[model samples]
Target chain A: MIKNFIVLLFLFGLGMIFSALLLGYTPDSELNLTGRYYAEHTAQDLGAANIVTAIIVTYRGLDTLGEVTVLFLTAAIVGMLLSTGAGKGKSLQRKLSQSGELLTTGSHLLVPLILLLGAYVFINGHLTPGGGFQGGAIIASAILLILLTDPLYRFSHQLISIVESISGLIFLALGVLGIFFAGGFLDNRILPVGELGSLFSAGAIPIIYSLVGLKVGAEFSSMLVNFSETEDS
Target chain B: MVTIAMLTGFILILMGLYGALTNHNILRMIVSFSVANTGVNIVLVAVGYIHGRTAPILNEAVPAAEAAARIIDPVPQALVLTAIVIGLGITTLMLAYAYKLYEMKGSLDISKFSELKW
Candidate 1:
């Protein structure tokens, strides 16, 4: 009872702090300096319709690289942590009952469409609200559905690793190319910025983002597969 | 409207923190942490909201020339995107750790593992 009281007391104090912040907060009527700069310059500088994409994929590309690396590390660690003592005595495993026909058929029908949508989202990252991370998550959800339908199914870890590696390498290579061919690292001006709002505009952003999408998708799929493979152990 | 969102976010953070503090189950704790993570993300995005502004996308409706006056901040949105991904990574790591703990002790109760307890 005393422990619970202490916890509640601490929470009450934290809530008081939060309420103070809330009461003092006021919505900005004008864009701040950094926001003003990006808003004013993104289209003209990067030819990207989506300012957030331009900021993430170009202006702050190195940070994004670090973010992807962190995600990779997380997936790798999860795989390493869970793979030990897994899949032993496969012959002794109990057979899982077959998934319902409706689920099987639905997953079959939805997987391809979901994959296509993920591709579309990342491909249009420079023009739309969605981007590499969102698209990659969407693709991972498709893989999850497949696993759901067939619990015993095993995805090709080799294929997933290969996709992840190649996309990461290409993403880095494109960033390097930006230094030689464009103004700076990860600059989207390697190719012509093109007319704004066009599919091929934003120079290297769409390509880089697409590569990021594939890499993230592959990494997430690898983690999911590693997780599912542990079910037998 | 922005105030409402921020208020909801703050409330969620408090609720999540309270749940995390009180929960004795590892799984429940992980779930509470996720709730708090989401609340943090919401507060972050809400901080970037501007009065009477559209998204930071430029098109015919929001012309490039007039973007500064028309759009909300994009930086916070980008930061929130990163935050969400990192949050997912952390949640996954916690779940994996919880699973390993469960495997070790065959229990999900936090108090059962007392090796680190003083």
Candidate 2:
């Protein structure tokens, strides 16, 4: 009863905070200075049609780098936790029931298509609503499909680690290259802005996003692999 | 209106918090936290939505020169995207922790693990 009372009190405090914020906020009729600046200068500066991509990849590249690192750290920790003998491995001598042949065949057909779509999403991120993170998740889900249907399927841990490490290295190099070639780190001016709205435009932004996509995909795949390796999947 | 969305998100967050605080199952608590994180994402996105403008993209539809007049703010959307990915990572890590806890104790009850509690 005391715990419930305390919880209700905390919730009431939270509710008060929300009401205060709601009372204070006013919808701006015009873009504020930062928004206005990004809106006006993003296309001209980054040559990317998607302003969000331009902001995420160029204006705020360091933050994205940190976000990717957090993902890497999570995957690493999960890997460590699930490694042999790290967690209690009960010897359950039971085999998982086989998935239907039709389901397996359907997943086999759909996996490649999903992978292709994931590729398309990240590749076109500079021109559309999607980006590296969304694309990476889609790729991970495709791998998840295979894991669910094929009980005995095992992705090569070595291969996944290799993909992850190489992409991360490339991402770091791209940031370092920005320091030398561009105005500063991740300046997006390193390459010709090119014509706006073109697939090959946005200079290194698309490349960076693609690298991020690959790294994220690999990290998520590693996590899935870790989770599925348990005695009971 | 934006208020409606924000209100809904706030309610979801409160409900999630209540669920997390009251639930005895570790997995249920984790799920409640995820729900709260989702509420946060929704609030962040809704806070950035403008009345009638399009997304902050420049093209034939929204010209480069007049983008400020035609588009919603892109900063919040970018922040929310990053937040969502980080949330996913954290959720996965928490689940792994829960699984380890279960493996060690053969139980999923949060109340059962009182060794660290002073």
Candidate 3:
């Protein structure tokens, strides 16, 4: 009872602080300096229709790269921590109950469509609301669906690693190329910023985003595979 | 609108914190933490909302020239996106650690693990 009281007291204090913040807050009628600058320059400077995408993929590209690196580290750590048991490379002998017919059939029909939508989302990151991270997550959901349908199914670790490595390498290489040809590292001006809304517009934004999507998707799939493959250790 | 979203986010944060503090099970704690993480992300996106602006996307509806005046802040949206992804990574890490703990102790109770305590 005393512990509950203490917790409630703490929460009450926190709530007070939050309410204070809420009471003092007012929605801005005009864009602030940074927001104004991004809004004004994102299109003319980067040729990306989505200002958020431009900011993430180009203006703050290095930060996004760091974020991806953090995700890579997380995946690597999870794999290392989980894979160090007696169930490393052994074939699956444990029997899993069959998933329902509805799920099996639904996954078969949806997996291809999901994969296509993921690809389309990342490819159109510069022109749409979706981007590399979201698309990559969608792709991972497809892998998850397959795993759910067939728990014993195995994905090629080699293929996933290769896709991850190549895309990461190409993403870094393009950033370096920006230094040589454009204003700075990861600048999207290496290729001509084509027609603003065209498929090939936004210079290298679409390519970089696509690579990011592939790398992220591969990383997430690898993690899911590792998690599913864990045996009763 | 912004006030409402911000209020909801705050309430969620408080509720999550209460759950996390009171929960004894490791899985419940993890779930509470995730709820708090979502609340934080919501608050961030709310902070960027302008009174009468569209999203920070330039299109036929929102021409580039008037973007500065028309769009809400994009920085917070981008930051929230990063936060959500990082939050997922952290949640996955926590689950993996929890699994390892379960394997070691065969229990999911928070009070059972005392090696690092004290």
Candidate 2 lDDT by residue in tens digits, A1-233:
99999999999999999989887888777787988889988887789999999889899999999999999999999999877574333423446788999999999999999999999999999998988999999999999999989745778999999999998998898888889998888677777889998888999888889989999999999999888877463
Question: What lDDT tens digits, residue by residue, belong to model 3 across residues B24-117?
Answer: 9999999999999999999999999998889888889999999898899999999999999999999999999998999899999999999899
The lDDT for every candidate, in the order shown, is: 0.92, 0.89, 0.93
Candidate 2 ranges beyond 4 A from true positions: A84-94
Clashing pairs in 3: none
Give the Å error, residue A177, model 3.
Answer: 0.2
Q: Indicate the worst ten consecutive residues by lDDT in candidate 2 chain A.
A: A86-95
- The alpha-carbon RMSD over the true interface for every model, in angstroms, is 0.6, 0.9, 0.7
Query: Scored by Cα lDDT, where does model 2 land?
Result: 0.89
Q: In model 2, state the lDDT of residue B5.
A: 87
All candidates: DockQ: 0.91, 0.84, 0.89
**How much lDDT does candidate 3 score?**
0.93
Q: List the residue pairs that clash in candidate 2.
A: none
Residue-level lDDT for B75 in candidate 1: 97
User: Clashes in each model (backbone N, CA, C under 3 Å)?
Assistant: 0, 0, 0
Residue B69 in candidate 1, Cα distance off native in Å = 0.6
Off by over 4 Å in 3: A89-91, A231-233
Across A1-233, the per-residue lDDT of candidate 3 in tens digits comes to: 99999999999999999999999998889889999999888888889999999999999999999999999999999989988874655648777779999999999999999999999999999999999999999999999999999987989989999999999999999999999999999999999998777889999999999999999999899999988988552
Q: TM-score for candidate 1, please give it.
A: 0.98
DockQ of 1: 0.91
* Number of residue pairs clashing in candidate 1, backbone atoms closer than 3 angstroms, sequence gap of 3 or more or interchain: 0
